[model samples]
Target chain A: MRRDRIATDSGRDVTVVSRNGAASARDAAAFSTRWSYARKRQLFLGALAAPALVYVLAVAVGPMVQGFLYSFDNYNLIRPGSRHFVGLDNYIALWRDPTARSAVINTFLFTFGAVTIEFVLGLGVALLMWRDDWFNRIALGLLLVPATVTPLVVGLVFKALLNPEYGMIGYALAESGLSGPRGLLAEPQRALATLVAIDAWEWTPLMALILLAGLKSLPIDILEAAAVDGATAPQRFRLVILPLLMPAAFLALILRMMDAFRVFDIIFVSTSGGPADATNTLMIYGVKQGLEFFNIGAASAVSTVIVVCILIMAAAFIAVLKPARNRHA
Target chain B: MPDRARLSLLARRFAICVVLVIALAPVVWLFSIAYKPTSDIFASPPTLLFSPTWDNFSSVFRYFNLGRLLESSLIIAIGSTALSLLIGVPAGYALARSTSPRAIWLAYFFLIIRTVPPIATLIPFYLLMRDIGLLGTWWAVIILNTALNSAFVVWMMFAFFRAAPASIEEAAMTDGCTDFGAFIQVALPTVVPGLIASAIFCVMFSWNDFLYAMFLTKADTKTISVALLSAYGTKDISWGTLGALAHFSTLPIVVMMIALNRYFVQGLTQGVH
Candidate 1:
């Protein structure tokens, strides 16, 4: 039933149950390497890739698939399996409803607006920090603070600072020529925008760090050549820098966009998508319907749609990233 | 290389200093609120200078019981990170050593998983955790985080271990190391940096998480992230406790990141590349 083949430190033993009868696979890989390059590399890579694969299937794919399928059935968590096939029922409900539409739009708006601002701000900051200098110490320390704090705290902190009556934001705004007690999230129109700004403050550093690394790795010759050609600063930035920075910028955009669409913690704490559902993103709606309302089928539908959207986005990124991956391969 | 370069560098550094101030203003304001006397919190000009006191800090620690919440957070953080590594390392190793096409799909699936929103199965996961008798317990959050973040660990560490030399394991094997033994005795010790990086990230995600912790947990099982939020985000909140806990909540991460800046930045950049 068991092979007591290996022991670790602390005397904890690991059973080596040989799958397909190759001990460690390295021997097989070694044998193949001498005779067949492809076989050896594949085996070597396969071994390296297997753990991540298992994790994806077990924790990720299983739920995503089940969640998708559950959409087709009117499966309620409270009442497990009454099992009626709703053909496009949830889809119709979501599309036909205005509230759902607002949430979906808000989700995309949050993603696009927040990530755009963050990318610009991040690039500006990263460019400022590109050269080695004294700013490195304080800048690194300061910029890194926002991303390091837990999101929930960020939400609460912003909630306090932005609250009217006593919050500092109200006092500051009054000092600035604005009227009294503007609900950053209390007003229906400004609620989503307010949440978007919070995300920008929190995550712009991510964009900066990525761009800074990319900038660090750029070949200096091109920039020097541009300067020698008597290129102006803006001209050099627009032509030489922007094109080269596309890869990292696009990568940050994709990442930030993905994260922004899933805005939950801050919205949950700050506005709860309030003042007429202006700030409610899909995640919040999913939580409200699925968790609070116990409508698993509708939630499943939302989950399925989200998966499709993510897949589409990921497919585009894969195309973007494919060249780099192939070069590495 | 000359005065012009020096000037540009100085200008660049000044700009960076401004950006740094902008980035850190919100967090610094938290401390300002924490240390300022209640009467001085919202003075007309907004007092930037004040005598610091322990009243707020003491209240946060004692009355708010941030200490207990910190304990809860530490346990869950360590538990999730450990469990993630435990499952992830072996799984990553298996992928690296195996010759299966399934590995490709598995790795891609992990990537896809990483991209998908966390709320996709919030209700179902809650129901499942509840079904399994794990709802509202500390283990519930630990297991949830482990499951959620283990894929990231496996993927990142897989690349690390895959790049590892197989000869050490081969030499160990011929000299009486078993399959698992060759890995542990000969391989794992050298991969500590990767493991440490992945562990830090795992801790970061599990600790930073608010949604799952908020939705799946009760008061006793609540983490410091929740504590931090409740102080600032709720209707019953006050500025004094919010600032104090904010200091404590952020200090650990800031210290860790500063100590491991290179590793932290490198890990972050790797996600893009």
Candidate 2:
């Protein structure tokens, strides 16, 4: 009888038999109309999302996946016919190859060094610029000019300035005998550090901006309550402010870390991973292998390693931050 | 003011001045070089006081085909920005308004896409472009840039739209506006700042990008960023030519940044949330 009633829902208007049956049919009809309305909405939303989804999957993900696959093969563009599967040889060779090994280590050093200095300096700048004033506002706008200039150009600017023979700073430093016999970039010991300084110069303002945003977003009353509770300025900053600023700090650090790990343009133009490969980084190595040497297999391997390292680092950040976030929540 | 407070304020201002000088000096030096004569550009002491000349600027324009490089850059930046906004803004709206449990996750997925290292995609993309016969064309760079930029736009606009009120769109729907009409007429107007911010970001990133432009473009299609590299690598290491080219490469973006910084700050703050 229930099955017959359900089947009759399709043609209930024509097949109304009793008052109870007619009432059931009316409810079913209403539910069906509502269901169709939701379905239509879902369809409309899905239509809107489809283009981007397709494009990303096709253009971005497709190449990345192919690159990953290429890592597992003896892929060489120059000798395309010679290509074949080579399981973990490329990965193994990265460890065996001294240049590749240095690239990985140098990338870590660069990421950590640049991000650390940027964060520290950025936080200081943010604190100084915290007050809503015209001076700070204009200063911030001017400060961001270096960050706006292409990183490639920033490297060139420094390269020109740091030329020991003709550069203003470099010539002075060389003449004073403050730097090594060679200029800053020419000295392997000083090159990476110099690069870090350059990176900080380019990126620290942006960091400050992000941290400033976070600082501004903190609730004023909460801060005042902390102050009224007899917290000193330093105590308040350490206890109340630092905790609140973590999310923005995390964003800043992660963004910087990701970019710094792939420090290409600056290092490429400045040193080209030279001074005895002191500044060799993953990106510089990968580009040299893939583009310059046409060693696709080795290049793809480095690329894969980089992606893996980034994922691991990102995961580590989330894991570290997750507990604090949960506690706050 | 009290002496102690006055002292602190002066010290703070002094420190800020120091920071500003450090930040602006390198850029100032680069800009100043564009006006310096060739001989003075390579001056051993790097003399500060020299008669300015437009010779370097004229030489860069004459030799490097400055007009063509800037045109390519403008087209690539504007092209990618326009295309990405077109595809991304609507999708961002849909994601923002959707009722599905997975909508937020999809938005984050787009955010993560922006972090994918260029190396991971560059090689295969090179081959893909070559196979498609678009290897050296602006379209090749545009296509790759659009993919990345549109994903960013999607994520950014998602945040913008979510922050925008849904009540107005619902009211529009109740007032007989179609769903698309509500989005276009009522909802879109509220996110104009977001649109501008996203456009600015796209232009800046695509404009500053040298790697993709370097790898994908032929001589005629190279961007100013790429040209900046070749200028540095010239046989004579023409600092004057580089300085002049740097003006083209960095000035427009810098100017845009200063002009639109308010939107940048607003957009960044909103997006991070």
TM-score of each: 0.85, 0.93
* Displacement of the residue A218 alpha carbon in candidate 2, Å: 1.0
**Quality of model 2 by C-alpha lDDT:** 0.87
The residue pairs found clashing in candidate 1 are: A47-B95, A47-B96, A47-B97, A47-B98, A48-B95, A48-B96, A49-B95, A50-B95, A51-B91, A53-B106
| Clash count (model 2, backbone only) | 0
Candidate 2 colliding pairs: none
Model 1 stretches with alpha carbons more than 4 Å out = A1-56, A75-85, A178-180, B1-3, B37-51, B65-67, B93-105, B159-191, B230-237
- TM-score between candidate 2 and the true structure: 0.93
- lDDT accuracy of residue A80 in candidate 1: 70
Complex DockQ per candidate: 0.43, 0.57
Report the C-alpha lDDT of model 2 over A159-224, residue by residue, as the tens digit: 988988778889999999989757999998889999999999999988988899889978999999
* Alpha carbon lDDT at A322, candidate 2: 49
Which regions in candidate 2 have their CA more than 4 angstroms from the true location? A1-32, A316-329, B1-7
lDDT of 1 by residue, B1-273 (tens): 899988988788777767777777777787778887766665554556788877777777665776678888899999989988887777766665554546645655555666688767566677677888888888878866777678877767666776677777777866876666777777888777778888889988988887788878888888888777656545444577678777777678867876776667767776566
Give the top-scoring candidate (lDDT).
2
The best candidate by DockQ is 2
